[model samples]
Target: MTEPAAAPARPLRRDVAAALLVLVVWLVPISEGAIQAAPAAWWPTIVRDLGSISCLFRHRPESVSYYFVQVLRSGRREWEAIDERALFPMEPFGYRSRFDRFMERFGHRSDAARLDLARWLAARDRELDPARSPVVAVRFLAGAQRIDRARPPAGRWHKPDPGAAPVRVLSSHDLRESDRKDMSEETGKSR
Candidate 1:
């Protein structure tokens, strides 16, 4: 059989440039992570456009945390967990519920915002089920369970155990007091 001709070899300069490009692409991300994690700022920003690069990828998956809302009705002794879907009926996706996201942002909100949220919840509770006692108080709860990274998740839907994980009350407000104050303010304004 006739011998097939060998393919032309790439130039040494071209090969070196290609290798350097690959090296730079890989190193930029590593350098970025080091720069962000450490206090030192040794990485040169002029070389790579780190500003444009999203920090979402840099987020290290922390412990699995869950946020939920509970309501204290006028006559009920025990707090009832509000159904997230019912509360946020317009929410399209379930990866994160609207109520949960609200709770996440709730930490940074002011006292006035808390009262607004409490008032909204109280009104919403009555609207959701008029037969049930009106919500006298609203409480936001947060719980986090340290996930073992080594182990695979048991199920697609993992319910964070309220019993196993320590539940924290992020904010609690008495709607009754707020309502009374609001009424008094309205009367005072009228006078």
Candidate 2:
């Protein structure tokens, strides 16, 4: 009896191999996610290949309160939003991701950190803009606004009444007082 001829071996094309590699790279996170016991166990990843469901029927919608840094520049009576561009010069494109992350981590941790940040900001403002007044005081404030499901788009995002006060003051530092204390300590004198 004659034996059947063996088929010739073929090598995988470079493109095919690369495609397979890409697929595997994408699947690593997904495969690991499938075995997680809880939703939170799936480590937060930017890869949203499958999509995500947030604040759906699974979670009740609620008011969102956010923390922000408000600086009181010298000669200005009103406390306004900080000029992030002036503080973070490297981020010329406008979105200050570094500042945002720093702010998020700055939530009511230590008094020293808050004071240091305020002092640093004041110094930067002084060096950058010699013409304008530097930041004399820095306040870490919390603001809140609620979304009304029953209201129209115009009235959907409802802020507190004009007379309503802030939710709370997270932290505040007067740079002038800090500078005075530093100067006194440097001169070996107590304030």
Candidate 3:
């Protein structure tokens, strides 16, 4: 029998092309993250879009630093820690971290963002356990770790200072109807 007509060259070419395409698709996010790490003024539009797209693929904890929500029940001096993950679950397809979303939407010091955060927390509290004490206030704490670039990357990480004061990002009291209206108006004006 004639040496089985050497496997069709066309199929081999197609397989190689498909492998390349898959590689490119996976590399897009990694490339974007690398570019973002060292931002430049001349980045092209495609690169910028890729950076946003990369959020769906990678979690940049460095960018997030540290953020937490503190919940104080009515008449309580001590605050309970509410984990960000409990509020926002990771999407199956997207790489967006809950902390990132929390910071973007409600981490700001503005009155509107605070009120919104408080309302959300109150609602969540009610949903979780109606018998629990009502949430009187919600506060956000944000802190950034100072990285030393000169140190070697591995084992050079520095934990956040235990004695360092946490930045109070947002604080809001139990919202009344009038306060809610004011917040709505403020939001409308800002938009």
Write candidate 2's Cα lDDT for 1-191 as tens digits.
Answer: 99999989776798789878666545654554454411333434354333233333444446554556678988888887766656765742234335544555555566787788788877877888789877899987666566577862463333233236465787889888988989888888542
The candidate, 2 or 3, that scores higher on lDDT is 2
Candidate 3 per-residue lDDT, tens place, 93-123, comes to 2444565555654465466666676788778
Runs off by more than 4 Å, candidate 2: 1-65, 89-96, 144-167, 189-191
**TM-scores of the models, in the order given:** 0.62, 0.50, 0.50
lDDT of 1 by residue, 20-42 (tens): 87666556555655666422244
Residue pairs of candidate 3 with colliding backbone atoms: none
- Per-candidate RMSD vs. true structure? 12.1, 8.6, 9.5
Native-vs-model 1 lDDT?
0.69
Prediction 3 global C-alpha lDDT: 0.60
Position 184, candidate 3: lDDT: 95
Candidates in descending lDDT order: 1, 2, 3
What TM-score quantifies how close candidate 1 is to the native fold?
A: 0.62
